[model samples]
Target chain A: MASIYIDNWHIVLAALAIFITGALSLLMQLGLAKSIFIAATRMIVQLALVTLVLAWVFEQDSVWVVLMLLLLMGGFATYEIRARQKLAFTGLWSLGLGGIPMVGVGIMVLTFTLTTVIGPEPWYAPRYAIPLFGMLLGNSLTAVALALDQITRGAKQRQGEVNDRLALGMSRTEAMLPIVRDAMATGLLPIINSMAAAGVVSIPGMMTGQILAGADPANAVRYQIMITFAIAGTTGITLLLATWLAVMRLTDNRHRLRLDRLRSQKYPA
Target chain B: MLIIKNLTILPINVERLELKGGVTALAAPSGAGKSRLFAAIADLVVNEGEVSLDDVNRNDIAATEWRKRVRYVSAEPSWWGNTAQDHLSDDEKTRQMAVRFGLTTELFERPIEQLSTGERQRFGLLRALVDEPRVLLLDEPTAALDQDTSLKIEAELVRLAGEGRIIFIISHSEAQIERIATRVVNIIGGKLREGKK
Candidate 1:
């Protein structure tokens, strides 16, 4: 049997589902039709653009091109991490604190997966490297963002308690440990729930996509399992490291609670 | 003695102030930078000055060490733990001080949310005194207490001063200051000025 292909008209035929949803939203007067349509349009455009770009990148088949794309993805992710926070750190720290962990975990886990597990020829093949790293980056990006946001907010809300501890001669680490722990818990909860729900509550997106694309079910399941482990490991380590970096940014060697480092109410949205 | 020279922290400036081993009452209107002065001396706020306790410069010691030795207690204390006992220092001195401040052993086991504002204030003081700090900076330390408890706390502050701990206290009650303070300082026109007791 040959792998089936989706023609452009076939894709437009699928567009009916989105139109139905938009119609239902409008019928209900839910005020969601506009946003739904906008989002749907954005997704279509973005994915189409990525398809074109990925086609070119794959044709080029150079490590330099792949690495540049990876850098671009990483840069966008770092900006997103900073943007999501209501009380993110003020300067380069807003990027560095979360970005460091994200980059670190993505490089380590993806490299391990490709080199040891997947082992596709050329190792850095855009085919595998791009998608794998995208999956890892997207997954860990949420974790790092959650941890950074939670830690900063926790520090601000718990300023009195932490300062009291510091006043009692507790080191900066001790003063910040509780908030850090709480943030890490908040960050890890999503990945934990996703992993728990992967097979039971839902067939995860990657596995479903692969199966729909005509890969053997057995092989797709293996890929899903490996990716799940990679995502989980990446998320946990990224959260821990991001919270650690946030705690450092929150306090200094003087053990003073540096609420000044926070951006006050300057959140964009 | 605690000595501050040429200290400037925002709206509050102190050219020179020397505090002996006694309770010095800091009095001013609301937002007069009275609390800011206390925070600066405790090294909790950013300030520019030379502060030394017995010739040991604030810069010479670690920030934690300085804060431990010179503790600052805020008026509205915070509780992160579920129970009051969790915030209380687990030590003989804290236990003894808790009882002396009229806190029952039962109060320790109760959830911190159940604590009254007055009760939390007392706990805040006890928390700072857990390790017997050399200097205590208190912001309205007894603002919530009744006349009876206020007098009792005043007596305790005097006694702590007798033990050679320099205490800086912020208060709005002139009567309370007259009753407890060894020396009085007022923040006037954004500057700490020595006032006649």
Candidate 2:
């Protein structure tokens, strides 16, 4: 193993700058200083706890430990997605339906296509598996949650217009497709932005860390590209599934919106 | 008939109201809780109240079924769908309804963000009626339109009510109430009183 010498203080100072700048922007734009503080605190505590847990898992060096950690990450992501959207139990089921498949396929690609491995054992190497799985699941969770949120809200808001289409004898899916497509694009913008900014504007954290640990620049670039591609694939599939599942569940067999399911009571009487 | 009895809403408190509907216009000054009363009867508001359609209690019916019986349109229609066309069904019946609301082929192809306010309001009202709901609740439906468009919307509402669908309109316009309202209900100081019965 190569000795990794990260200047902890330097990282802390940079992270502080990022956090303060983010908080200032939120305060100015959204008037949400308190919310920014709460969210930043959440990010800090969660990441810190995950770091400690990861240290233990890495040291134990067991396949089971890696599996457990990965599962925990996925579960946390699921909970966060549902909570952030204020989704009901229906959302819970759809998150699993949408998220788990992407995670599975990502794991398969990483283990079999990217490296020479099959089954749970060889795939559990913490140095490789943890970061890759974390990256995939984290991106998938955001994409799925965003798609679900936008589509569900869209379906309800456009209920009338949708019903007019339905009255025109449009199929349920047909009535919903345009909005679903739009929501899918909104969910995808983040990944696209990340890809666009990866090399020219900013060196990605993963690539920078790898280079700092003395990996060849070419090898680090190659890994970064592969990981980025995988994340994009995972996020795209998850967005499609999440939007489809959410829209299907919103409508009944006849394609009418189940308005009772929406938590918002914004409709004028 | 649309029946509301002893429907008490809070925050914006409406102590009690009893009414049977026939083109009833709910007229109130701005922020006088007329909209909240409609929302309460529709069971869309979270409050302690009893509402019924015929003999069936509004709260007892499955929310979806109850919603199917009554459609509510806000002053500012919720623009939740991804595109303009997403709001309509693929069927010709719905398309015809969209045409009735003045939606053209180009409108269907355009995103909702590009739609004019008048177009969206018409679409909102048409959407409510097309579901064939027994009751319709409209909040400031013509508030944003020109005189001719407003008259067209009122005519549409009158036609629907004439077909036996109960229609309740909340309007700030006295002329609007006179034109379409069979009976006007007035709210003042948080109390419901019959106006020009």
Candidate 3:
């Protein structure tokens, strides 16, 4: 059985549904009607642009092209992670602390999955590689960003406690261990919640998308399981790496809390 | 001796000072940078010039190592864990010190959040003594204690100093200073001067 395709007119019909929802929101004075319309328009334009770029890349089927695209995705993920942080290291340290660890984890996990687990006809096939890379990069990016932000803010808020520990003869790493652990827990919460509620509470986006695209239910479920595991593994490793690197940057070799490196003053309450 | 040479601790300057092995009470009015000077000596804050313990320069030793030898207990001590026992070392000396400070073993088991400011201050002093530091930089260690408890703590600190351990204490009470301090210095206009004995 073939799955029904969504043509232009169908997409237009979906827009009409969104417009009706927006109109109702406006009538009810929800105050979110304008935001909804703006967000919807942005999504349409961005996705349309992505579709065109993806089509071009798919046609090339070159390894270099695929690799470049993957790098671009990782770069943007790194940028977004840095941008989201409340307290960040100065200059290139900010970029490299989160960026290097995330990209390193992304490349390692994606390579392992594509080469060993899936093993498509062309190992560098954009169709499989790009989407998989995107999923891993995007999820890990959020995790790393959250972890960095939490740990940085945690260190700032607990500066006195940390200094007291240091005065008690604890090393910098020893003093910050609890903060790092807390940050890791904070970073992995979303993934943990999703994993707990995967099938029963809600169908995951990947699984639902695959099933909608004519894939067999069983096959789609299996793929979803693999991707979920991959995401969990990637996020854990990336968050740990990011937190460690960030903490190292925040402290000096002499075990002093160098909160001076942070650019922002909005500390945790 | 704890020596300070031309130490410029931003808004406070010490041309030269030698703190021998005894309680050298630092007395100054409020906002006189007494704690700031102590922080400088402990390397908790940045300062220009030199600080040396005996003949070894602070720069010659690692910061962590320096802090271990020259421990600073703040006015309002910070505790991290739920139990006071968690912050203390498991040793006979620590237990004896706790007992001497009127901190019952039962108090150690109780949550730190339940501890009053006075109890926390006692625990803070105990925590600092755990490392057996050669130089103790205490900022108002007995500020929250009652008269009897303050005198007891002062006697213990004087005893520690008599054992050749250097101690710098920031105290507001001249009577307490007279009771415990071997020498006294007054901080005025960001500088140190000899005070009444």
Candidate 4:
């Protein structure tokens, strides 16, 4: 067995913690100081446990473990998206609509085009699996949540016009399509901006890591491009799926908005 | 049967009201809770008392479903979308209803923003009436219209009520109320009193 010495990790982490605490203090009152301390402590403990498990995952990783990790990430992302927005989708089908296709596309891009390491053993190496899928899943979750929130608010604000369309025999989903399309464009704007600025202004995280680990800049750039393309496609697909699912739940079979169940407080403050 | 029991409302401040579904004309000072009372029954206002239909508690019924059966048309005709046709459709039935109300097919596709005040008022009321609600909650439905349009809408209200729909109207026009309201319930300082015809 080989010994690992990840030097200066603690020092960097401590500095990050101090910075985070300073920011939290600026946001909270003196009365909330204890609550902030408890929250920070919990975050630290959880991250530490995850780090230990990831270390083992890297050492003896197999493809099965990678698949499980991806599913876990997607499941947790789905739950987090629902919790933060306080809205549920049509059903589990919507979750899979957003999740499976996205993670699958991301895996294909990472495995075939991006990397050189080819082996059945350690195929699900934490260093690669976690960071790659994490970025894809995290972005998909955020984009879906934002689109759903915006679309729901837009529909409510324009309820009169929506009802008019309903009176004209447009189904609830058809009535909401314009609003959904507008929201989807808004949700994709950030990623588009990032892509536009990717090479000149900023290098993305994965590309930066590969460069730091002695991979050629050109190769890293190539990998980053592929990942970005994959992410853009997956994100668009996931957002569409999530928005469709969320909006479908807003109506009943009779084709009217189930307004009483709406989580109105979830609107942006 | 919009049964409002122990109905307390606060449009500006604390106010209380109680009413049952009928041709009730609400008359009050501008800042009083007449509109608030209407909104309470429509489930638009954040109210405390029970607003029930028949023996069924509205609190148990989904507000949206309950609202579908009891239409609340605001005086300020909410202009949504870009055009008139976008606001309301010109389907065969809607067109026939428009013709019945003396509206032209041109008004159907015109953007609501482009419609005249009277046209918008007519359109708003038509939007509500088209649903065939059991109870019609009007927040001064003709407040934005001219005298002629107001009279015409008043006629439409009389007709609608005559067809057995429960109409609750909030109005300042003594003439209109006298002409149309089967029973006028005056609310002065948030208290309800049946006005003598």
DockQ sort, best first:
1, 3, 4, 2
- Tens digits of lDDT, candidate 3, A55-132: 999999899999899888888887787788888778888788888888888888988998998998688889999999
DockQ of 3: 0.65
Q: Compute the lDDT of residue B97 as modeled in candidate 1.
A: 86
**lDDT on C-alpha atoms for all candidate structures:** 0.86, 0.72, 0.87, 0.69
Chain B TM-scores, listed for every candidate in order, come to: 0.96, 0.91, 0.97, 0.89
Preferred candidate (lDDT higher): 3 or 4: 3
All candidates: TM-score: 0.95, 0.58, 0.95, 0.60
Candidate 4 TM-score, true structure as reference: 0.60
Whichever of 2 and 4 has more DockQ, that candidate is 4
Question: Tens-digit lDDT track for model 4 on B124-195?
Answer: 778778767778888888887788778777777777787778898988888888888878877655567768
Tens-digit lDDT string for candidate 4 (A103-154): 5655665565335543333455667667777787777777776776677677
Which of candidates 2 and 3 is the stronger one according to DockQ? 3
Candidate 2's residue-wise lDDT over B100-189, tens digit each? 666677777677778888887777766667767888888888998888888877777887787888888898888888888998888866
* lDDT tens per residue, model 2, A1-269: 48566686877876787678777878688666667677878997989998898788879988788777777777777766666564442534645655565566556655653365323445567877888887888787777767777787777667755654443345668778878987898889888998999988999988998888889989999888878888898788777766777777777664556656656422221
Model 1: per-residue Cα lDDT over A138-202, one tens digit each? 98888887787788888888888887777677888898898888888888888889888988999
Interface RMSD of each: 1.2, 7.6, 1.4, 6.5
The weakest ten consecutive residues by lDDT in model 3 chain A span A260-269
The DockQ scores of all candidates, in the order shown, are 0.66, 0.05, 0.65, 0.08
Chain A, model 4: TM: 0.75
Model 3, A269: alpha-carbon shift in Å? 19
